[model samples]
Target: MEAIANGLILLMLSIGHAELWTSVINRTHALKIHEVYLKRLRHVLELLMVLFPLVLLFAVGLSDPGVLVGGEWSQLPLWWQPILLLCTLGFLGLIYSGVRHQFYRPPRQQTAQESELIHLRERLKQDLIGEGPYHYLAGLPFNEIFSVEFTRKTFQLSRLPEKWEGLTILHLSDLHFSGTLKREYFIELCRIAQEMKPDLIIFAGDLIDRMECLDWLQETLGPMQAPLGRFFILGNHDWNQESLQIRQTLSETGWIDLTAEPVRLQHEGQTLFMAGTEAPWMGKLQDVKLSEDNAADDFLLLVSHTPDNFHWAEREGYDLVLSGHTHGGQVRVPPFGPIFAPSLHGTRYTSGTFFRGSTLLHVSRGVSGIHPLRWFCRPEISLLTLHSADKK
Candidate 1:
């Protein structure tokens, strides 16, 4: 019984250590850190997450430290003391985060959500980029990378304008375009987008991961259009590449650049605002002032590359906010949820619909990532339909 108890304690402590490091990694990704440096840091941290935990489990837990190291706990090496202290603190953090996860509840604005899974590989019948990077993992027994989830969510907003009772926006973000998933996958995704036939379309960010795949946009997102407009912003991944050229190409292809200032449009004879921010990567939150009288008609929609800006959008009185940077943690562990999300809030805003004050935030799971592996989390294309919950 003591051995089992000790093993459980060590396991929890190890999880705590990993989660604490995950927070560090998540916050670092939120900044403008170099990809190469961040990658190396992640590798080193991963090694430490394993090595440190194993050493403690074997040296202390198994041997019952007080017996092996002579009577008092302080008799152990000085280094071991700090390690033990950090482990205990990490376990506390794990318990706190776990409590938050357990109590997570969606806001009342989310009326309903429906999902459909599309199997691109079986449907296309042909090999989609045969033997791309990490092809073995792609074929893992239950890997969900290729299985796309087309989710349609309904948000009932009390502040919605009467003119736009039912407004649909197809939000597509984080199409990494790394050549790992192949061209057909993206083309098919675009085809489905066209079929949805939304009023407007928004590509949040991270359009191109590899510069070589820049031309692929012509066949994929280039042809996609909507009645209102198609707007886009560059993500950190795109910023790392030739962002100017990528922006130019996207602009030439018909998508409006929202990375600048807010754009005003006339829809249903009511004024609407569209804005984008790549904060902590490209720029900061935009400043805007709205007339109190026109609040009924002026609907502000902000596209942020990361959900970290959700609170900012809420405070700024945005009607809707769209984001996709964490990619639903790329891989999720059920019951415990996602372990590593690239946001300061850790895995809290990884993905899904969240409501804060008057703002409704939708974080997409995203199409793909730089590293091509998705276990329980499927890539998502969200179609958000906004309805007026205002009785007046």
Candidate 2:
């Protein structure tokens, strides 16, 4: 029993070490640096996260006079103390994040909401794309890559202006049309989104991973109909491609380039300011005009590719922010939630409706990603219905 307990402890510490460095790698990916540099840093950290634990295990658990043999704690070398301390600290930090995730609640600023989840796999079993990368993993018994969820959620916010009440926005992001999943998958998801009949449509970045998939747009996002219009911003993946061509092709397909400039809409005598930000990757953030009288009355909506911009959006007095780069960590571990999110905030904004001060952020669990794998996390599209809480 003693030997078993010591072995378990070593395993726990190894996991902690990996998690610690994974947090660092996620934040590093959020920097305004080049992708090549970020990839190099990630590889180094990941190697350390794995190999360091194995070295320590060989030294302390597998050798003579080691803990696994029920050796006295004092038998360890003096130099090992600080390393053990760091391992313990990292384990504790991992526990704290888990606790927070287990107890996480929707922000108090949100008054009420309803969510309906539609499992596409069940509805269109034979119609799914049926082929993609990671066939080894996607073929796993419960892999959720093809189980797209059409999540229709309503948000009742006190800040919603009367004119915008009952307004619906279909939020889509991170399509990553890398051909890992065939074009049919994207076409079907987009068709369902159009069926939702939203007043406005927003694609919050990461449209495609392969330029060859560019032709997939017309049958997918091109025909999407919304009275308010379709707007988009490019994500880091798009930056790695022929971004200028991507932008031009998207514009020609009729989606307005929100990152190019801020858009102001006058509706039912109400003002709405909309803009997009692709910071830390693509374009710069567009500033809302201050010249308009009663600028405060305009309901401000900022579309950011990364939810890490939540703080900046809050400070800028945005009423709502939409984003979708993290893909809800691509996979979620129960109790611990998401373990891998590419954001400065770690997994805090993995996917959800979070309210900070006056700004409400809705992060999408995007449809597909580069890895083409998912466990507990399913591909998601959200139809967000905004309602006024003043009626409450």
Error of 2 at 90 (Å): 1.4
- The Cα local distance difference test for each model comes to 0.83, 0.83
Task: Residues 1-392, candidate 1: write the lDDT tens digits.
Answer: 55566566667767778877877888898888978899999999888888877676667654645422333455567877676678778777766766766677768899988999998888898766534456566666787888899999899987678878778999999988877788988999999978999999999899887788999989999999899999998899998989999999999999899876678888877778878898878876754334345455688888899999899889988889999999998887766677788888888898888988889999999998877778889999988898989695
Stretches > 4 Å off in candidate 1: 62-82, 130-135, 287-296
TM-score of each: 0.92, 0.92
The whole-model C-alpha lDDT of candidate 2 against the native structure comes to 0.83
Worst 10-residue lDDT window for candidate 1 reads 64-73
Instruction: In angstroms, give how far residue 269 of model 2 lies from its true place.
Output: 0.6
Model 1 has an lDDT value of: 0.83
What residue pairs clash in candidate 2, if any at all? none
Model 2 regions lying over 4 Å from their true place:
33-37, 111-136, 286-294
Model 2 over residues 1-392: C-alpha lDDT tens digits?
Answer: 98888888888888878888988988887877776788789899988987987887878887756888668667888888887887878888788888988898877655555555556667666645434445456556777888777877778777678877789999999999877777777787899889999999999999877788999888999999899899999899899888899999999999999888888877778877888888878755545333355466788899999999899889878889999999998878888888889999898899988988889999999988878788888888998888887573
Residue 324 error, candidate 1, Å: 0.4
